[model samples]
Target: MPCTQKVTDDIVWVGGSDRRLALFENVFPLPDGISYNAYVILDEKTALMDTADAAIAERFLTNVEGALAGRKLDYLVVNHMEPDHCAMIGEIVRRYPEIKLVGNTKTFRFMEQFFDFPLQDRCITVKEGDTLTLGRHLLHFVMAPMVHWPEVMMSYDSTDKILFSADAFGTFGAFHGPIFADQINFQVRYVDEARRYYTNIVGKYGPQVQAVLKKATGLDIAILCPLHGPIWRKDLGWILDKYDKWSRYEPEEKGVVIAYGSMYGNTEAAAEELANLLAQKGVTALRLYDVSKTDSSYLISDLFRFSNFVLAAPTYNNGVYLPMNALLHDIAALNLQNRQYSLISNGSWAPISGKKMDEALNKLKGMQQVGETVQFRSSLKAEQLPQLKALAQAICDSLK
Candidate 1:
C-alpha cells in the first residue's frame, strides 16, 4: 500500500521519511531522522514536483504512482539538484519515458554530470520568469541561486497559490502522519531540529536566502510545500518570519548558550559554576553543552538560537582544545554573526586558549567579546569567583 497524504483536493504528497539514516549528508547527526518531501499536482496534465532520496525509493515510487492513479506523469519539475532529492531522476525518466523533465540550464548541466542519462530532447530548460502550464495549474519558476545550491528554484502554483519551495523552508526530522504544520506542536517538537537544519545546512548562504525571500514577498502564497518536513498551510507567517530572521543572522531569543570542553572535568566545573550564577540571577532559558560530547551541529543550532554565548575550554599544548576549536571553526565557516560571546580558558601552566579563542572569534563579523577573559590555572579557584561573577553579569546585561 502507498503511504501518502493529500495536500489539497488536487495536490498529493508523494514523499516518504527515513528514520534509519544516522547522518544527513554524512555530516549532521539525525537523532530524529529526516524526511524527503515530494508532491504531485493532479490536473488536466499531471506533474510531479520533485523526487525523494534513493534510500526510500521503493516507497516513494509507490506513493507517486499511487497518487497518479494510473494518470501518466506529464512533467517532472527539477527543483534542487541535490542527490537526496534528485537521486531518482534517472529512475523517474526510465519509468516515464515520454515525461518532459523541466528545469533551468544549470539544473540540466548538474543532472548530466551526476548521471550518465542522455537528457538532450527530454529537457525543457526554463529561465527566471518561465511558466509551465498544465491546464488549470500554472507553475512559475523563481530562480534561487545559492539559496543553498546554484540550480535551486521554487515553483509557484498560480491555481492554488502554493509555493513549491525546494529546500528554503525545510527542516530535519521524519514525518509522523500529520503533514501540515498546524496539525502538531511544531514549536515544541520540530523547531529546534528545524533551526539545526537551517543554521547548519543553509546558514552560510544568508544573502541568497534574503534575495529569494524578497522575490517571494511580491506573490501571494497560500501554502508552503518544502522538500522536507511538514507543509505550511495554516500559519505561513510563522515559518516565513523564522526564515527572515535566520537569513539576517539575528538571534531568535535573548539567552545564553554555554559550551565547554574539558579534559579532566576542570573546565566543565567552571562552565557549571557560571551557569548556576546566571540562573541565580534570574536568567531563564540557559543552554549548556559539552562541546566534546555534543555534536557541533547541535551546538551550532543553539549558537544561532541564543544571542549570548559563553565558551569555556582548557588549553592543550598551548592552543585551544580540539573540540572547542572545531566548533569555533564551524561557527565562523557558517558565517554566523551579530552575537555577543564571553570566554573562559583554563591552563595548568601557561594560558593561551583564551587569546587563541578570541583571535578565532575575531575573524567573524559582528561578534563582540563581552567582559574580561576569565583565566584560571588548573581549576577555577576561589580567587577567580569574582571574575566569573563579573562575566556572568556581563552576559545577563547583554541579554537585556
Candidate 2:
C-alpha cells in the first residue's frame, strides 16, 4: 500500500521513513532513524518537490504513483543534488518519460556527472528569483549556493505560502505516524537531533545559510516543507529563529559542554569533576561526555548549543587522545565559532595533549580559551583540585 499524507488540498506528502539505517551518510549515528520527505503538488500541471532515497525507493515510488492517480508528473524539482535526495531521479525519469527536470545550471552539471541518463530537453534550468507556474501555484526559486551544497536552492509557493526547503531546516529522525512538527513534542523529542544534523552536516556553511535566511524574509511563508524530518505548519518563527541563530554561529543557550577522551578513567574523572564543580557553582546547563563512548556528532551538536566547553584528553603516543583528536579535527573542520573553551590534558610522562588541543582549537574563528590549560601527570591528585576548581570557576564566570 502507498502510505502518504496530505499537506494541503492539492499537495500530498509522498515520502517515507527508514528506521533500519544504522548511520546517516555512513557517519552520523541515527539511533532514532531518519525520514526522507517528498511532496506531490497536484495542479493543472503536476510537480514533485523532490524524491526519496534509494533505501525506500519501492515505497516512495508507490506513494508517488498513488498521489499522481494516473496523472503525469510534469516537473521534477531538484532542490539539493545530494544522493539521498537525488537518488530517485533516474528512476523517476524512467517512470515519467515526459517530465521536465527543474534545477539551476549547476544542478544540471552535477546531474550529468552523477547519472548516465540522456537529459536532452528534460532540463529546465532556473536561477535566483526564477518563477515556475503550475496553475494557481507560483513557485519562486531562491538560489542557496553552499547552504550545505553548491547547487542547493529552495522553492516557495506563492499561492499556498509553502517553502520547499531543500535541507536548510531539516532534522534527523524518523516519523512514526505524525509528520507535522506541531503534532509532536518537537523541543523534547527532536530538537537535539535537529541541532546535531545542522551543526555537523551543515555547520561549516553558516554564511551561506545566512544568505538563504535573508532571501526567505521576502517571502510570506506559512508552511515549511523540508526534505527531511517533520513538516512545519505551525511555530514557523521558532524554527526560523533557530536557523537564524545557528547560521550566525551564535550559541543557543548559556551552558557548558565537557567532552573528555580517556584510555582508562583518569581524564573522565577530571571531566566529571569539572562538570560537578560548574554545576555546584550555579551553572544549571552542564553536560559531560566521554569522547570514546559518545559520537563526535553529539559532541559537536552540544558544542554549538552551549557557549562554553571543556576538552579533556590524555596524551597518546605524544599526541592528543585519539578520539579527542578526531573530535577536535571535526570541530575545526566545521568552522565552529564564537565560543569559549577550556582544556585538560593528562599523560604518564609527557602531557602535551593540552597544548596540542589548544593549537587545534585556536585555528577556528572566534574561539577563546576560558581558563589556563590544566595539565596533570598520571591522574588528578588532591594538589590539582585548586587548579580544576579555578578552571571550573572560569567556565562558570564565562557562562554569566
Candidate 3:
C-alpha cells in the first residue's frame, strides 16, 4: 500500500497511487496520485457522497471518522454503481450498520447484482423531484437515467448550491489535494479527460441528459462534485456550458476526425493518403487520431468537434482491429446522428475490416456512407493508388 493522505478541508482525497496505476476504470493517470473522492458533508446530520474502492475503503472510513468527530455516520449515497464507486459498500455497511443507504430502484437492482447487498427494502429509495433534508443542507435527488448507468441519480444541495453529479463533469488526472476546480487549471489538464468520460460513458444518454438539464434549470448550481477528479467551484458556468453542448451532441466546428487502426504501414499509409486527399478537397480542418496510440480522451474530444468521422484499418483475423472496434463501439454508444463518414481498409487475402466497419457504423442513425468501400492489400500497391484517389474524391463529395 502506498499510504493515504488528506487533501482538503471537507473533501479528504484518500489514495496514494502513481500515474501508471489506474484505480478507476477508464481513468487517465494523474501524477499527483489517483484520489478516490469521497466527500463528507457535516450538516445537521452527516452525509457521505459515494464511497471509494475496496483498497481505499479503510482510508475512506478514516476520513468519515475525522469529519464526524463526535457525530455518527448518518447516510452513504451511491451515485454510480460501477464497482470503482460501489465496491466498498458492503464493508461500509458492516461498519455503519445503522447508516441509511440512499439510491433509487435501479440502484438497488445493481447493488444486488454487484455484491448481493441487502439494501432494497432497508434503504431510502428516492425518485425524480424528491428532496431529503439534512438540517440546513437540503439534498435534492433528480432522476438522471443512463448517464452511463441505468441506476444512476445525482443529488444537489440548495443551501450549498452543490450538485453531487456522480460521474458528470468529471476530469481525468491525479486527484489533486484541493477539491475545488478553482484550485487547479482544469482547462489545461482536466477538460479533455472530462470530454472523454462523457463520450465514452454518457454519450448514449443524450435524451436522459436533456431531462436532467431541464430539472437542473429550475435550481441554482454553484459547485459540481463528481465521483472522480476535482470539484467545480470556480468558473462553474464554464463547465455547465460545456456539459450543455456535449449532452446535445453539438459539434464545436466543421472538421474531420480521421481515426484508424493499422497493423502494418499499409493501412496507415492509406489513411495518410486519405488525409492529404481530404486536404486537397478543401477540408483543411483535419484531425488524425491513430486509435492504436492515441488515448480515448483525444479521440472523444475530436468527435465532439468534427461533424465528419473517418475510420481506416486493415482486416485482422477476419475482423476489424480491436482498438478500432472499441472506438467504434464507444462512438456508436453516443447515439450520434447526421454525421458523414468514410472508410478505407486493407487486408492481404480478405478485406473484412471495411465490411465489418460499415456494419458497425450502419447501426447509427442518419449516417451517410461515402461512395463504396475503398480496399487495399498487404502494402499500398501501384494498382491500389487509384483507389485511394477515388476514396479521397468520394469523401470530398460527401462534404459538399
In Å, residue 42's CA in model 2 sits off its true spot by 0.7
Q: Clash pairs of candidate 3?
A: 30-174
Clashing pairs in 2: none
Give each prediction's root-mean-square deviation over alpha carbons: 0.9, 1.0, 4.0
> What's the C-alpha lDDT at position 27 in model 3?
52
Which regions of candidate 2 deviate over 4 angstroms? none
* Residue range 143-178, candidate 1, lDDT tens digits: 999989999999999889999999988899998889
Ranking by TM-score: 1, 2, 3
Greater lDDT among 1 and 3 belongs to: 1
Tens digit of lDDT per residue, candidate 3, span 1-400? 2233333344344432224555346454333445456677776777778887666666666766666676777888778888878888888788777899888888888888888656644689889878888887788888787777788899988887888888777765655455667777878777776776676667777778878878778889877777777777779778877778777877756778999888767778878888998788788989887899987656876787677888888887789888998888777766776678888887889988989999988888778887677877777887877877887787777666
Give the distance in Å from residue 208's predicted Cα in candidate 2 to where it truly belongs: 0.3
Per-residue C-alpha lDDT of model 2 across residues 201-243, encoded as one tens digit per residue: 9999999998888888998999999999999999999999998
Candidate 2 lDDT at 298 equals: 95
